[model samples]
Target: MIKLRPQPLRGRPTVSVVVPCYNYGRFLPDCVSGVLGQEEVEVDVVIVDDASPDGSSVVARRLAAADQRVRLIAHETNRGHIATYNEGLAVAEGEFVVLLSADDLLSPGSLARSVALLQAHPEVGMVYGFSPTFADRPPTPRTTARSWSIWPGLEWIEQMCRRMSNPVSTPEVVMRGSLMREFVGYDKRLPHAADLLLWLRAATRGPIGRINGADQAFYRKHGANMHVEMFAGVYTDIAERRRTFDILFDEDSACFPDGHQLREVALRSLAREALVTMCQAEKLGQVGDEPHDKLVALAAEMCPPERDPRLWRAYERTQTRSRSGRGPVVPRTVGRAMADLGGRIRWRRWRRTGLMSAVGSL
Candidate 1:
């Protein structure tokens, strides 16, 4: 038998665009126009502003008032990302909903491709497309599979827990509006990984679908991206995600409990470690002990003995640089030591002193 590819859907499909906005005044116009531009398919814009001070609420209201297709929800007080998305999900009426960040812009007709997959495979819980970076500055280029041959039976929870990559990026994901409520929407506590957590369960529980396409959404990178803050303990968001996954999977005991994302969790931890290390190393020049040791403890949590390099020798390399009246030159040994030193710090002032573990060993 010849393996033939799935054909695209033929008719206009209903697609709802849910734009979760905050104080994103600059690029939001692109987000709105992107949704409205998909003329071939019916689209709805559900904009929820989490009490942004820069007048995003006013913008949302104006868009709602101007276009019958757009609906605006205003939060009197500042609600977080999860609550804002929940507000939009509660009232969205389209057959499928796509959450578009205010800072993101969609490639033309991206939604129609997603709608085509969902329309063809009625059994699938969610259909997601690829979203490569679209803003002019270098966007993070993500390459992943476009289609999956999902069978009628399997346990999604266990699979998600065991494998690290959830595959469904927040921007590329388009979901059946009804299924959003089938689960508890998004867990408000896991705001850091809320979208991933929800999509993980959705993809696993039902037959998952994917659309490989060149056109994707634009994820704007700037000083304000939440991921940068992840180093300051946001990446520990894995902890929150772990907590949520355990409880949710437990409630349905028939599904196995996942201790962690297993693969991605450690990779994410390493990334957070690198970020915390760089931030801490930078802070050592500008600030004092409290922030310093906070990173010290963070470094300990992040870098283990098998991974960390020797910081004492990294300082020695600095001494070498100082001797030559120039900046530090990291020697080969010292450089390796500098590369990994998270696991070798003291937890408390009273319990021990600055970095006792690797001194004698190094």
Candidate 2:
């Protein structure tokens, strides 16, 4: 399955967007609309409905009715996240495929730009773009990177040994679907984090490319953000993620420092998992206890001198400070209460109206 260049293909390489939907009835339409609104390409949409309790299937079917390119695959019973994506990937016949989560929305021209980037750069195997977040409340802006590049070819098993600069947003990717089939599909072992591991595996095999263009997708940060609802699953995700990397660069491999670095990463992940679990359980005071001390010592033994964590990093929100190092003043009780109520009302209204299509520009 050669990935025919969109530039040289008889027509634009057919780009398929695999939208996996569960109970995201409210955001489904806008998510579908955002992709439908792209420019200059043959777009095929695959809407995989995971037996939504809500009427998400109705919305997806309606879109399929109106557009021939839109196809709906309704499951009889709900399969987990990774399986749903596997189902989508199984049926995809496009040169490039975009994995669009149901709760998210794509920016206009996202697929077009991603396909064009891969098309223009012959050596690039997979190409991705950036995403702006549209959480239920406004999302904080991410620190934009200076550039995006991953050795750009399968020949980078060497470069990946040196730099692991993978900053891909899956929703913003239009990757070579043909090449994607070469590897095992999403590991059911690590459902949600499977994509991140898949990308890492790609890095080990070759190079991934990024289109340094405008924001290409919108990640909705509502109360139902997939990761937010599954905090308990984080450690397991990290473990599986590390195992995936370890398989590629375990000791005895020619990839220098790669095997060593990855093993250290696995140990670090384990320590981080312990710290995070303790933090979530509000057992911060026990950081020097049995499990904690054990993880810390193992981390010291496994990691390079500079990489060891003597004390775990605690995640705590901090107040914004001025140039004088003074934090912003809090309003009086009455004002604070009133502002909270007002915010609740406004967000409820916004949620009711339903943010259709994460708008292209901001």
Candidate 3:
């Protein structure tokens, strides 16, 4: 473990942006420029090069030398991302802190808006805005509002639990530096969902603030992205999610105050995630017997005995769909037409009933 000493601030920056780079030397210029260009907020940038094989250290050193607000932390040995993040956190002295990936870019004026929200609401432990993801090309930037919504922390957690997946992108969210310092840094055990767990922990401390607008940050969805690797089966998504919820339950039991209620919510969330995972695997034609059997066993153990029938039924449906394939074996042209029609129907239903919000309520 690396020991972090607090550094003396020169003029007190309102926000500290930590850009952790690992072999992303090409994107360093854009990432650093984005942080420096934010309007109306005093910001400091710490770029940590985790011993990248690429020339990331060279780029980081250049930025640090050119600007007093920008500092570079170059590790001799390549430490993992979590270690790099903690090192940056230890050095960060701003009231609001963001752990941004070097491959990602913050939208124009995002810092100013997020800072305003946090300044206005002392009850909010974290604030996040809309993060549009792109693959080949970045999206057009939009002007964000100075306005935001404050939702109860528990409410946000419940909504997140119902979704069974992370909605907040990593770069777009900012944490209260004081709250961050109070807790241990991100959980090393949760390699895939550490950010999610951190977000949940922050929510437990205070209400969550959301800046309701587009263009807070640009999440570059390239082949080397961490989530891309996780979904591609580089890590076991099921096991990671289980560990995430376990950590959440253990850490936030005081906030929950009801052990049985927390356990039930965790179980339901796991079961929902398992079903979703099966459906995704079926769509990809990657559902092998061994993994499928393991998923079934995991679901059975997590779910209550009384609720096992419904869970098993859902699991069986996924299995049948995987075996039979999705829809009929029609011609390519007909298949496209059917898919378009189904998408339209789903969209109409979503618009009429607000499917996502309704599900969250449940």
Residue 49 displacement in candidate 2 (angstroms): 0.6
Which lDDT tens digits does candidate 1 get at residues 34-145? Answer: 7898756888888888889998888777778888988788788997888888888877778888888898877766777667667777877776555554444435433322
Per-model tally of clashing residue pairs: 6, 2, 0
Model-by-model lDDT, in order?
0.59, 0.58, 0.72
Per-residue CA lDDT of candidate 3, range 152-200, in tens? Answer: 8887777666655566778988888998887656778887888889988
Best-fitting candidate, scored by lDDT: 3
Ranking by TM-score: 3, 2, 1
Q: State the lDDT of candidate 2 residue by residue for 1-362, as single tens digits.
A: 12222332234568888899999878877888777877777788999999998989999999999988899999989888888998988888888877889888776566766676567665566766566667663243332323444453333433332222224557777667776777545767655556756665665554566644256677676556422342344434444545555665553356444466645545554544444443432221222333534433443453433664333323222112222444223433543354346445644432322111110110
- Evaluated against the true structure, the overall lDDT of model 2 is 0.58
Please give the lDDT score for candidate 1. 0.59
TM-score of decoy 2:
0.66
Worst 10-residue lDDT window for candidate 1 reads: 349-358
In candidate 1, the residue pairs with backbone N, CA or C atoms under 3 Å apart (3 or more residues apart, or in different chains) clash, namely 299-342, 303-343, 308-340, 309-337, 309-340, 310-337
TM-score-better candidate, 2 vs 3: 3
Runs in model 2 deviating more than 4 A are 1-11, 136-166, 224-237, 250-262, 265-362
Which regions of candidate 3 fall more than 4 Å away from where they truly are? 1-13, 224-231, 283-290, 317-362
